[model samples]
Target: MALKETRRPSIFWLMAWVCFGLLGGSVKFRVAHPERIPERGAFVIAPNHYSEIDPVIVGMMLYRLGRIPRFLTKASLFKIPVVGWFLRRSGQVPVERAGSAAAKGPSPLAAAREIARAERIVVVYPEGTLTRDPDMWPMRGKNGAARIALEQGIPVIPVAHWGTQALMGRYAKKINLLRRHPIDFAIGKPVDLSEFEGKPIDQHLLADATEKIMGAITAELEKLRGDKAPAHRWDPSLHGQSETGRIEP
Candidate 1:
């Protein structure tokens, strides 16, 4: 028999915000530049994916900042136990990374296109998974965000989040109430991808663009956390430090 899918229901956002509020995770957001995004249209909020709870933290921040977003999550996450139910109830979109060719399910790109033509927002984590880096530095991301941004003429807003990893760990599992750390988010001005609208999304171009976005996000995180910039080649193994140390910024 085919496996059933899990998703987040529309009310998930409401419940998630309440849960976080009760848990004491502070939510702060600032939109320094709104011109980056169009006055009123579909746009992409591309952020670095660092922990499991990142969606909730970032999603709530977006909502509080006056934008309701449709988040793209992993298909496998929708098959979990109770969590799966909550995801579906929250109206989250589940994406199949593998066997995606079988059928065109609700892809992030599709959601982005819809956002471009609709009134809602789409939250896409370019980095498909949590960062393996101990410092939580963003790894190389996929081309999904770039493709949607260029193809649909939508603005790309880069969001940076910090502190959620402490509550959920690098690889999110159960809640870490013991840590009880505070989290913060910073939203950068939207980026215009019209220059590459029609050009092929080559690896070099995509990588460069993704790197630029990640860099901006990391910088914001650093500013918020009062941390120094990480070395361009920040390999913990080379320095004999644990991967967790590099995760802060």
Candidate 2:
């Protein structure tokens, strides 16, 4: 099933599709269980983030599935001139630091409310940034995706993709697109949060929900890559690595 388009594609999205379409020609997108995405309405997509190019791949994959894609973009990007104009016009949500309530940007719930105002897919990286895993496994999830879902009463769909690291390493400054890349996206069903339906939003509850969301995505990634993930998800705090910036593992 494909997501139902509720509105016409804006000029930015139209151009974005054409641009990403050309980029996709050089990279093969092998999608599995795309039917997991709902045919209508706004829903959160929780995907593992390992490479800087991951967002492009996810956006391309969603558009291929008949859905217009949006993202929780960094607030700094919105401060730029031309790129910011495109991002705002394209309807991407802006956040200071995703999933952080104390951060000095727009509220996370406000981002969710904005997402609910439309019918597009919002791709959220629960890890908040590139994974610090030495092997690029999914790391500990932030509460942004879960907090958004719970605040706005939307589904959190767990998705995972592999092979982008081969296109470009985690902290590498260069991206090699000379060779055709085969990237696989495994879209899992919406994570069930029935247990937390009426509970007051709290740090404990958000952490648990984030765990389930990340677990579902990790499971999907394991299936796509056919490799077992680490027994414990990587935590930057434990490894003395900065949480929001590049850290070689």
Best by TM-score: 2
lDDT for each candidate structure: 0.64, 0.82
Tens digits of per-residue lDDT, candidate 2, 1-249, equal: 333462455754665666575675578888898888787888998989988988877887777777777887878788899888888888787877645543767765677668776755677788988988888889999998898888888999998998888787787788776888898889888899889889999999999999999899999999988989999999989988888877654
lDDT of 2 at 101: 42
The lowest-lDDT stretch of 10 consecutive residues in candidate 2 is: 1-10
- Cα RMSD for predicted model 1: 7.3
Candidate 1 lDDT tens digits, 97-197:
55654266666677567656765567888766666555667655667777777767667788777777666766545877654576766667766455566
Residue 206's lDDT in candidate 1: 76
TM-score of each: 0.73, 0.90
Could you tell me which 10 consecutive residues in candidate 1 have the lowest summed lDDT? Answer: 1-10
CA error at residue 218 for candidate 2, angstroms = 0.7
